[model samples]
Target: MSREFEIAREFEVDATPEQVWDAFTTGTGGWLWPMDAPEPREGGTGPFGSTVVTWDPPHRYTNRVANVEGIAEQTLNQLDYTIEPREGGRHAWVRYVHSGIFVEDWDNQYDGADKHTDFYLHTMREYLTHFAPRPVAFTTLDGPEASKAADALSTAVRGLGLAEDVPAGTTVEVRGPDKGLFPAVVDYHNPYFLGLRSDDALIRVFGRNHWGAPVGISVHDFAPGADAKADAAAWQRWLDEVFA
Candidate 1:
Protein backbone atom coordinates (compact mmCIF):
# COMPACT_ATOMS: atom_id res chain seq x y z
CA MET A 1 0.00 0.00 0.00
CA SER A 2 1.18 3.55 -0.71
CA ARG A 3 0.15 6.94 0.62
CA GLU A 4 -0.20 10.32 -1.04
CA PHE A 5 2.24 13.10 -0.09
CA GLU A 6 1.08 15.10 2.89
CA ILE A 7 2.70 17.52 5.34
CA ALA A 8 1.51 18.84 8.67
CA ARG A 9 3.03 21.25 11.18
CA GLU A 10 1.84 22.76 14.44
CA PHE A 11 2.85 26.16 15.77
CA GLU A 12 2.31 27.98 19.04
CA VAL A 13 2.03 31.67 18.38
CA ASP A 14 2.17 34.37 21.02
CA ALA A 15 -0.88 36.12 19.73
CA THR A 16 -4.64 36.05 19.97
CA PRO A 17 -6.77 33.84 17.74
CA GLU A 18 -8.09 36.83 15.85
CA GLN A 19 -4.62 37.99 15.00
CA VAL A 20 -3.60 34.59 13.69
CA TRP A 21 -6.72 34.30 11.55
CA ASP A 22 -6.06 37.65 9.92
CA ALA A 23 -2.49 36.65 9.13
CA PHE A 24 -3.53 33.62 7.09
CA THR A 25 -6.49 35.05 5.20
CA THR A 26 -5.20 38.50 4.30
CA GLY A 27 -2.64 37.65 1.59
CA THR A 28 1.09 37.24 1.17
CA GLY A 29 1.30 40.67 2.74
CA GLY A 30 0.10 38.95 5.91
CA TRP A 31 2.78 36.19 6.22
CA LEU A 32 1.52 33.46 3.88
CA TRP A 33 3.42 32.62 0.70
CA PRO A 34 3.27 35.39 -1.86
CA MET A 35 -0.14 34.97 -3.50
CA ASP A 36 -3.23 36.99 -4.10
CA ALA A 37 -6.58 36.17 -2.44
CA PRO A 38 -9.75 38.05 -2.97
CA GLU A 39 -12.43 38.62 -0.34
CA PRO A 40 -12.69 34.83 0.12
CA ARG A 41 -16.34 34.47 -0.77
CA GLU A 42 -17.53 30.87 -1.02
CA GLY A 43 -17.97 29.70 -4.66
CA GLY A 44 -16.10 32.80 -5.85
CA THR A 45 -12.78 32.58 -7.69
CA GLY A 46 -9.67 32.67 -5.50
CA PRO A 47 -5.97 32.87 -6.06
CA PHE A 48 -4.63 30.08 -8.29
CA GLY A 49 -7.86 28.31 -9.07
CA SER A 50 -8.68 27.78 -5.43
CA THR A 51 -12.06 27.76 -3.70
CA VAL A 52 -12.82 28.73 -0.16
CA VAL A 53 -13.94 25.53 1.49
CA THR A 54 -14.41 26.75 5.05
CA TRP A 55 -14.33 30.20 6.58
CA ASP A 56 -14.91 30.26 10.31
CA PRO A 57 -13.17 33.25 11.83
CA PRO A 58 -10.64 32.75 14.64
CA HIS A 59 -11.05 29.01 14.39
CA ARG A 60 -10.57 27.09 11.12
CA TYR A 61 -10.33 27.68 7.36
CA THR A 62 -9.82 25.49 4.33
CA ASN A 63 -8.92 26.00 0.69
CA ARG A 64 -9.03 23.48 -2.11
CA VAL A 65 -6.38 23.99 -4.76
CA ALA A 66 -7.54 22.61 -8.08
CA ASN A 67 -5.13 24.35 -10.45
CA VAL A 68 -1.81 25.79 -9.34
CA GLU A 69 -1.02 28.24 -12.15
CA GLY A 70 2.04 26.42 -13.53
CA ILE A 71 1.64 22.86 -12.29
CA ALA A 72 0.16 20.15 -14.49
CA GLU A 73 -2.96 18.07 -13.93
CA GLN A 74 -3.68 16.80 -10.42
CA THR A 75 -6.90 16.16 -8.59
CA LEU A 76 -6.43 18.74 -5.84
CA ASN A 77 -4.39 19.77 -2.83
CA GLN A 78 -6.34 20.42 0.34
CA LEU A 79 -4.96 23.19 2.54
CA ASP A 80 -6.50 23.17 5.99
CA TYR A 81 -5.71 25.34 8.98
CA THR A 82 -7.10 24.99 12.50
CA ILE A 83 -6.51 27.57 15.20
CA GLU A 84 -7.16 27.07 18.88
CA PRO A 85 -6.93 29.65 21.59
CA ARG A 86 -4.53 28.92 24.42
CA GLU A 87 -4.05 30.39 27.88
CA GLY A 88 -7.48 31.94 28.03
CA GLY A 89 -7.23 33.42 24.56
CA ARG A 90 -3.94 35.15 25.17
CA HIS A 91 -2.11 33.04 22.61
CA ALA A 92 -3.03 30.58 19.87
CA TRP A 93 -2.04 27.20 18.51
CA VAL A 94 -2.01 26.70 14.73
CA ARG A 95 -2.13 23.47 12.81
CA TYR A 96 -1.60 23.48 9.04
CA VAL A 97 -1.94 20.42 6.85
CA HIS A 98 -1.32 20.33 3.12
CA SER A 99 -2.46 17.04 1.63
CA GLY A 100 -2.10 16.11 -1.99
CA ILE A 101 -0.96 13.43 -4.42
CA PHE A 102 2.06 13.46 -6.68
CA VAL A 103 2.22 11.32 -9.76
CA GLU A 104 6.05 11.26 -9.75
CA ASP A 105 9.12 12.36 -7.84
CA TRP A 106 7.29 12.46 -4.56
CA ASP A 107 10.45 12.82 -2.50
CA ASN A 108 11.62 16.05 -4.11
CA GLN A 109 8.18 17.61 -4.05
CA TYR A 110 7.53 16.57 -0.47
CA ASP A 111 10.94 17.74 0.69
CA GLY A 112 10.45 21.17 -0.84
CA ALA A 113 6.98 21.59 0.61
CA ASP A 114 8.00 20.35 4.06
CA LYS A 115 10.79 22.87 4.40
CA HIS A 116 8.66 25.67 3.01
CA THR A 117 6.01 24.97 5.66
CA ASP A 118 8.50 25.86 8.36
CA PHE A 119 9.65 29.00 6.60
CA TYR A 120 6.15 30.33 6.12
CA LEU A 121 5.07 29.57 9.69
CA HIS A 122 8.09 31.33 11.09
CA THR A 123 7.29 34.32 8.94
CA MET A 124 3.80 34.34 10.40
CA ARG A 125 5.09 34.30 13.94
CA GLU A 126 7.47 37.12 13.15
CA TYR A 127 4.65 39.12 11.67
CA LEU A 128 2.34 38.66 14.67
CA THR A 129 5.10 39.37 17.16
CA HIS A 130 7.13 42.12 15.51
CA PHE A 131 6.07 43.37 12.09
CA ALA A 132 2.26 43.03 12.31
CA PRO A 133 0.05 45.66 10.61
CA ARG A 134 3.10 47.74 9.67
CA PRO A 135 3.79 45.88 6.41
CA VAL A 136 6.93 43.78 5.72
CA ALA A 137 9.10 43.64 2.67
CA PHE A 138 9.89 39.94 2.11
CA THR A 139 12.69 39.09 -0.30
CA THR A 140 13.92 35.65 -1.35
CA LEU A 141 17.03 34.58 -3.28
CA ASP A 142 17.95 31.04 -4.27
CA GLY A 143 21.22 29.44 -5.31
CA PRO A 144 22.43 26.01 -6.33
CA GLU A 145 24.64 25.34 -3.31
CA ALA A 146 22.10 26.80 -0.96
CA SER A 147 19.60 24.09 -1.90
CA LYS A 148 21.88 21.05 -1.93
CA ALA A 149 22.00 20.17 1.77
CA ALA A 150 20.64 21.57 4.99
CA ASP A 151 23.88 20.85 6.82
CA ALA A 152 25.90 22.89 4.34
CA LEU A 153 23.72 25.98 4.69
CA SER A 154 23.74 25.54 8.46
CA THR A 155 27.53 25.59 8.44
CA ALA A 156 27.62 28.78 6.38
CA VAL A 157 25.02 30.48 8.55
CA ARG A 158 26.97 29.59 11.69
CA GLY A 159 29.69 31.95 10.47
CA LEU A 160 32.29 33.59 12.75
CA GLY A 161 33.00 30.29 14.48
CA LEU A 162 29.52 30.07 15.91
CA ALA A 163 28.38 26.53 16.71
CA GLU A 164 26.47 24.45 14.17
CA ASP A 165 23.50 25.73 16.13
CA VAL A 166 23.65 28.91 18.13
CA PRO A 167 24.23 28.45 21.84
CA ALA A 168 21.06 28.32 23.96
CA GLY A 169 21.53 31.36 26.20
CA THR A 170 24.87 32.92 25.35
CA THR A 171 24.62 36.06 23.21
CA VAL A 172 27.03 35.43 20.37
CA GLU A 173 28.12 37.75 17.59
CA VAL A 174 27.09 36.53 14.15
CA ARG A 175 28.32 38.21 11.01
CA GLY A 176 27.02 38.36 7.44
CA PRO A 177 29.01 39.52 4.47
CA ASP A 178 26.99 42.65 3.86
CA LYS A 179 26.00 43.40 7.45
CA GLY A 180 28.81 42.83 9.88
CA LEU A 181 28.03 41.65 13.39
CA PHE A 182 24.44 42.15 14.51
CA PRO A 183 22.73 41.17 17.73
CA ALA A 184 20.36 38.35 16.95
CA VAL A 185 18.86 35.33 18.66
CA VAL A 186 18.22 31.91 17.24
CA ASP A 187 14.44 31.95 17.28
CA TYR A 188 13.74 28.58 15.67
CA HIS A 189 15.85 25.71 14.39
CA ASN A 190 15.14 22.43 12.66
CA PRO A 191 16.92 20.36 10.05
CA TYR A 192 15.14 22.15 7.22
CA PHE A 193 15.01 25.74 8.47
CA LEU A 194 16.91 28.28 10.56
CA GLY A 195 15.26 31.44 11.84
CA LEU A 196 17.13 34.34 13.42
CA ARG A 197 15.34 37.19 15.10
CA SER A 198 17.43 40.33 15.18
CA ASP A 199 16.50 43.63 16.71
CA ASP A 200 15.06 44.92 13.45
CA ALA A 201 15.08 41.95 11.11
CA LEU A 202 13.93 38.38 10.73
CA ILE A 203 16.37 36.34 8.64
CA ARG A 204 15.75 32.79 7.51
CA VAL A 205 17.48 30.12 5.44
CA PHE A 206 15.43 27.33 3.90
CA GLY A 207 16.74 24.04 2.55
CA ARG A 208 14.35 23.31 -0.28
CA ASN A 209 14.24 20.80 -3.13
CA HIS A 210 12.04 22.01 -5.91
CA TRP A 211 12.29 19.79 -9.00
CA GLY A 212 15.96 20.70 -8.44
CA ALA A 213 17.32 21.33 -4.97
CA PRO A 214 18.06 24.99 -4.26
CA VAL A 215 18.77 26.95 -1.09
CA GLY A 216 16.54 29.96 -0.36
CA ILE A 217 17.42 33.02 1.71
CA SER A 218 14.81 35.45 2.98
CA VAL A 219 14.95 38.68 4.95
CA HIS A 220 12.09 40.54 6.62
CA ASP A 221 13.14 43.88 8.04
CA PHE A 222 11.09 46.02 10.40
CA ALA A 223 13.43 48.90 10.94
CA PRO A 224 11.73 52.20 11.63
CA GLY A 225 10.78 53.92 8.38
CA ALA A 226 12.73 51.36 6.37
CA ASP A 227 13.23 51.08 2.63
CA ALA A 228 12.04 47.71 1.27
CA LYS A 229 13.85 47.94 -2.06
CA ALA A 230 17.21 48.80 -0.52
CA ASP A 231 16.85 46.07 2.08
CA ALA A 232 16.09 43.48 -0.61
CA ALA A 233 19.16 44.49 -2.62
CA ALA A 234 21.42 44.31 0.42
CA TRP A 235 20.18 40.81 1.23
CA GLN A 236 20.64 39.72 -2.39
CA ARG A 237 24.24 40.93 -2.32
CA TRP A 238 24.79 39.11 0.94
CA LEU A 239 23.39 35.89 -0.53
CA ASP A 240 25.77 36.19 -3.47
CA GLU A 241 28.74 36.54 -1.16
CA VAL A 242 27.64 33.71 1.13
CA PHE A 243 26.99 31.30 -1.74
CA ALA A 244 29.85 32.52 -3.90
Candidate 2:
Protein backbone atom coordinates (compact mmCIF):
# COMPACT_ATOMS: atom_id res chain seq x y z
CA MET A 1 0.00 0.00 0.00
CA SER A 2 1.21 3.54 -0.79
CA ARG A 3 1.28 6.14 1.95
CA GLU A 4 0.47 9.84 1.52
CA PHE A 5 2.01 13.03 2.94
CA GLU A 6 1.21 16.75 2.87
CA ILE A 7 2.63 20.00 4.29
CA ALA A 8 1.37 23.59 4.10
CA ARG A 9 3.10 26.90 4.92
CA GLU A 10 1.81 30.46 4.91
CA PHE A 11 3.63 33.78 4.56
CA GLU A 12 2.69 37.42 5.07
CA VAL A 13 4.40 39.63 2.50
CA ASP A 14 4.53 43.40 2.17
CA ALA A 15 3.34 43.54 -1.44
CA THR A 16 0.18 43.43 -3.49
CA PRO A 17 -1.41 40.32 -4.93
CA GLU A 18 -0.68 41.49 -8.45
CA GLN A 19 2.98 41.92 -7.60
CA VAL A 20 3.14 38.46 -6.09
CA TRP A 21 1.48 36.94 -9.13
CA ASP A 22 3.92 38.61 -11.47
CA ALA A 23 6.80 37.22 -9.48
CA PHE A 24 5.37 33.74 -9.93
CA THR A 25 4.67 34.13 -13.63
CA THR A 26 7.11 36.70 -15.01
CA GLY A 27 9.72 37.77 -12.45
CA THR A 28 10.98 34.20 -12.26
CA GLY A 29 14.52 35.45 -12.42
CA GLY A 30 13.87 37.17 -9.14
CA TRP A 31 12.37 34.07 -7.52
CA LEU A 32 11.26 30.54 -8.41
CA TRP A 33 14.61 29.37 -7.15
CA PRO A 34 16.16 29.88 -10.59
CA MET A 35 13.75 27.37 -12.10
CA ASP A 36 12.17 27.70 -15.53
CA ALA A 37 8.80 29.41 -15.75
CA PRO A 38 5.61 27.39 -16.13
CA GLU A 39 3.18 28.21 -18.87
CA PRO A 40 0.08 30.17 -17.86
CA ARG A 41 -2.27 27.32 -18.66
CA GLU A 42 -3.08 23.78 -17.76
CA GLY A 43 -0.55 21.14 -18.85
CA GLY A 44 2.40 23.53 -18.89
CA THR A 45 5.88 22.30 -18.00
CA GLY A 46 7.88 23.77 -15.12
CA PRO A 47 11.50 23.48 -14.11
CA PHE A 48 12.73 19.90 -13.60
CA GLY A 49 10.02 18.87 -16.05
CA SER A 50 7.06 19.16 -13.67
CA THR A 51 3.61 19.57 -15.22
CA VAL A 52 1.24 22.36 -14.41
CA VAL A 53 -2.22 21.37 -13.17
CA THR A 54 -3.66 24.76 -12.24
CA TRP A 55 -2.90 28.33 -13.37
CA ASP A 56 -5.23 31.01 -12.17
CA PRO A 57 -3.92 34.55 -12.44
CA PRO A 58 -3.00 36.36 -9.23
CA HIS A 59 -4.97 33.83 -7.22
CA ARG A 60 -3.87 30.19 -7.30
CA TYR A 61 -1.37 27.96 -9.13
CA THR A 62 -0.18 24.39 -8.85
CA ASN A 63 2.38 22.04 -10.40
CA ARG A 64 2.98 18.32 -10.04
CA VAL A 65 6.15 16.26 -10.28
CA ALA A 66 6.21 12.50 -10.81
CA ASN A 67 9.80 11.96 -11.68
CA VAL A 68 12.47 13.92 -9.81
CA GLU A 69 15.82 14.20 -11.50
CA GLY A 70 18.67 11.87 -10.40
CA ILE A 71 16.64 10.20 -7.69
CA ALA A 72 14.83 6.92 -7.32
CA GLU A 73 11.22 7.76 -6.86
CA GLN A 74 8.19 5.70 -5.86
CA THR A 75 5.77 8.55 -5.16
CA LEU A 76 4.19 11.65 -6.59
CA ASN A 77 4.82 15.28 -5.55
CA GLN A 78 2.43 18.19 -5.99
CA LEU A 79 3.09 21.86 -5.19
CA ASP A 80 0.24 24.36 -4.85
CA TYR A 81 0.41 28.13 -4.42
CA THR A 82 -2.37 30.49 -3.37
CA ILE A 83 -2.35 34.28 -3.12
CA GLU A 84 -4.85 36.60 -1.44
CA PRO A 85 -4.97 40.37 -1.07
CA ARG A 86 -4.61 41.93 2.35
CA GLU A 87 -4.75 45.37 4.01
CA GLY A 88 -7.06 46.68 1.29
CA GLY A 89 -4.79 45.54 -1.56
CA ARG A 90 -1.64 47.08 -0.22
CA HIS A 91 -0.20 43.77 0.94
CA ALA A 92 -0.65 40.04 0.25
CA TRP A 93 -1.02 36.67 1.93
CA VAL A 94 0.56 33.61 0.34
CA ARG A 95 0.25 29.91 1.03
CA TYR A 96 2.25 26.96 -0.32
CA VAL A 97 1.16 23.36 0.04
CA HIS A 98 3.09 20.24 -0.88
CA SER A 99 1.11 17.02 -1.00
CA GLY A 100 1.72 13.63 -2.48
CA ILE A 101 1.93 9.90 -1.88
CA PHE A 102 5.03 8.16 -0.59
CA VAL A 103 5.84 4.47 -0.42
CA GLU A 104 8.61 4.61 2.18
CA ASP A 105 11.00 6.84 4.05
CA TRP A 106 8.27 9.45 4.14
CA ASP A 107 9.65 11.27 7.16
CA ASN A 108 13.07 11.97 5.71
CA GLN A 109 11.69 12.99 2.31
CA TYR A 110 9.15 15.35 3.80
CA ASP A 111 11.68 16.92 6.18
CA GLY A 112 14.08 17.73 3.36
CA ALA A 113 11.34 19.27 1.27
CA ASP A 114 9.99 21.30 4.19
CA LYS A 115 13.38 22.84 4.97
CA HIS A 116 14.02 24.11 1.43
CA THR A 117 10.53 25.58 1.27
CA ASP A 118 11.44 28.17 3.92
CA PHE A 119 14.41 29.48 1.94
CA TYR A 120 12.44 29.81 -1.29
CA LEU A 121 9.66 31.73 0.47
CA HIS A 122 12.25 34.11 1.91
CA THR A 123 13.53 34.78 -1.61
CA MET A 124 10.03 35.65 -2.77
CA ARG A 125 9.63 38.22 0.00
CA GLU A 126 13.00 39.76 -0.86
CA TYR A 127 12.12 40.14 -4.53
CA LEU A 128 8.72 41.71 -4.00
CA THR A 129 9.88 44.13 -1.31
CA HIS A 130 12.88 45.65 -3.10
CA PHE A 131 13.62 44.26 -6.56
CA ALA A 132 10.28 44.07 -8.33
CA PRO A 133 9.87 45.57 -11.83
CA ARG A 134 13.62 45.46 -12.30
CA PRO A 135 15.17 43.24 -14.97
CA VAL A 136 16.60 40.56 -12.72
CA ALA A 137 18.71 37.47 -13.52
CA PHE A 138 19.25 34.56 -11.12
CA THR A 139 22.11 32.10 -10.82
CA THR A 140 22.49 29.10 -8.45
CA LEU A 141 25.83 27.57 -7.46
CA ASP A 142 26.12 24.31 -5.49
CA GLY A 143 28.89 23.10 -3.20
CA PRO A 144 30.14 19.52 -3.25
CA GLU A 145 28.93 17.87 -0.08
CA ALA A 146 26.01 15.74 1.08
CA SER A 147 23.54 15.38 4.00
CA LYS A 148 24.73 18.47 5.89
CA ALA A 149 22.86 19.60 8.98
CA ALA A 150 21.65 23.18 9.28
CA ASP A 151 23.80 24.01 12.31
CA ALA A 152 27.03 22.89 10.61
CA LEU A 153 26.33 24.85 7.45
CA SER A 154 25.40 27.90 9.51
CA THR A 155 28.77 27.81 11.28
CA ALA A 156 30.66 27.74 7.99
CA VAL A 157 28.67 30.56 6.44
CA ARG A 158 29.05 32.73 9.54
CA GLY A 159 32.79 32.11 9.68
CA LEU A 160 33.04 33.82 6.28
CA GLY A 161 32.22 37.12 8.07
CA LEU A 162 28.64 37.37 6.85
CA ALA A 163 26.19 38.73 9.41
CA GLU A 164 23.99 36.27 11.28
CA ASP A 165 21.25 38.83 11.87
CA VAL A 166 20.70 42.17 10.12
CA PRO A 167 17.83 44.58 10.18
CA ALA A 168 16.13 45.64 6.96
CA GLY A 169 17.52 48.75 5.20
CA THR A 170 20.95 48.48 6.79
CA THR A 171 23.98 49.07 4.57
CA VAL A 172 26.50 46.28 4.51
CA GLU A 173 29.51 44.98 2.56
CA VAL A 174 31.25 41.64 2.42
CA ARG A 175 34.28 40.39 0.51
CA GLY A 176 33.94 37.42 -1.77
CA PRO A 177 36.53 34.67 -1.97
CA ASP A 178 38.44 36.68 -4.59
CA LYS A 179 38.68 39.63 -2.19
CA GLY A 180 36.17 41.60 -4.26
CA LEU A 181 34.00 43.93 -2.22
CA PHE A 182 30.28 43.69 -2.90
CA PRO A 183 28.02 46.18 -1.16
CA ALA A 184 24.27 46.11 -0.66
CA VAL A 185 21.44 46.80 1.77
CA VAL A 186 20.14 44.08 4.02
CA ASP A 187 16.75 43.17 2.69
CA TYR A 188 16.15 40.20 5.03
CA HIS A 189 18.18 38.01 7.33
CA ASN A 190 17.50 34.75 9.17
CA PRO A 191 19.45 32.04 10.91
CA TYR A 192 20.14 30.10 7.70
CA PHE A 193 19.42 32.65 4.99
CA LEU A 194 20.68 36.13 4.01
CA GLY A 195 19.07 38.37 1.40
CA LEU A 196 20.76 41.50 0.04
CA ARG A 197 19.50 44.02 -2.48
CA SER A 198 21.68 46.61 -4.25
CA ASP A 199 21.40 49.01 -7.14
CA ASP A 200 23.12 46.45 -9.33
CA ALA A 201 21.91 43.08 -8.08
CA LEU A 202 19.96 41.04 -5.53
CA ILE A 203 22.09 38.55 -3.64
CA ARG A 204 20.89 35.62 -1.46
CA VAL A 205 23.14 33.26 0.42
CA PHE A 206 21.53 29.98 1.57
CA GLY A 207 23.40 27.88 4.12
CA ARG A 208 20.76 25.18 4.34
CA ASN A 209 21.77 21.72 3.25
CA HIS A 210 19.96 20.52 0.14
CA TRP A 211 20.96 17.00 -0.90
CA GLY A 212 24.22 16.28 0.88
CA ALA A 213 26.37 18.59 2.95
CA PRO A 214 26.17 21.04 0.05
CA VAL A 215 25.43 24.74 0.55
CA GLY A 216 23.56 26.59 -2.22
CA ILE A 217 24.17 30.22 -3.17
CA SER A 218 21.96 32.15 -5.58
CA VAL A 219 22.58 35.60 -7.07
CA HIS A 220 19.89 37.68 -8.74
CA ASP A 221 21.42 40.35 -10.98
CA PHE A 222 19.23 43.35 -11.67
CA ALA A 223 21.71 45.55 -13.54
CA PRO A 224 20.65 46.46 -17.04
CA GLY A 225 22.21 44.22 -19.69
CA ALA A 226 24.03 42.19 -17.07
CA ASP A 227 25.64 38.88 -18.01
CA ALA A 228 24.01 36.18 -15.88
CA LYS A 229 26.34 33.43 -17.00
CA ALA A 230 29.41 35.46 -16.13
CA ASP A 231 28.03 36.40 -12.74
CA ALA A 232 27.25 32.77 -12.00
CA ALA A 233 30.81 31.79 -12.91
CA ALA A 234 32.33 34.36 -10.60
CA TRP A 235 30.06 33.34 -7.73
CA GLN A 236 30.79 29.70 -8.43
CA ARG A 237 34.52 30.40 -8.13
CA TRP A 238 33.92 32.20 -4.88
CA LEU A 239 31.86 29.35 -3.43
CA ASP A 240 34.48 26.83 -4.43
CA GLU A 241 37.11 28.77 -2.54
CA VAL A 242 35.03 29.31 0.60
CA PHE A 243 33.86 25.71 0.86
CA ALA A 244 37.29 24.29 -0.07
Number of the top-ranking candidate, with lDDT as the measure: 2
At residue 209, give the lDDT of candidate 1: 36
What is candidate 1's CA lDDT for residue 187? 75
Candidates in order, TM-scores: namely 0.82, 0.81
Q: Which stretches of candidate 1 lie over 4 Å from their true place?
A: 1-3, 28-30, 72-75, 144-151, 158-161, 167-170, 177-179, 209-212
Report per-prediction Cα RMSD to one decimal: 3.1, 3.2
As for candidate 1, its clashing pairs are 146-215, 147-214, 147-215
For 61-178, candidate 1 gives per-residue lDDT tens digits of 8888754557653456878889999999999999999987665666766767777777777778877987677666666667546546545566556543467756434465768646
Q: What's the distance in Å from true for residue 4, model 1?
A: 2.6
lDDT of each residue in 1-244, candidate 2, tens digit only: 4677888899889999999888876636777555677877899886577898998888998988885665564457788989999999999999989888766666666666676677678777877877787776778877655415546455444544565555667887767656777777776665556666777777777765633446777788888888878888887777666655
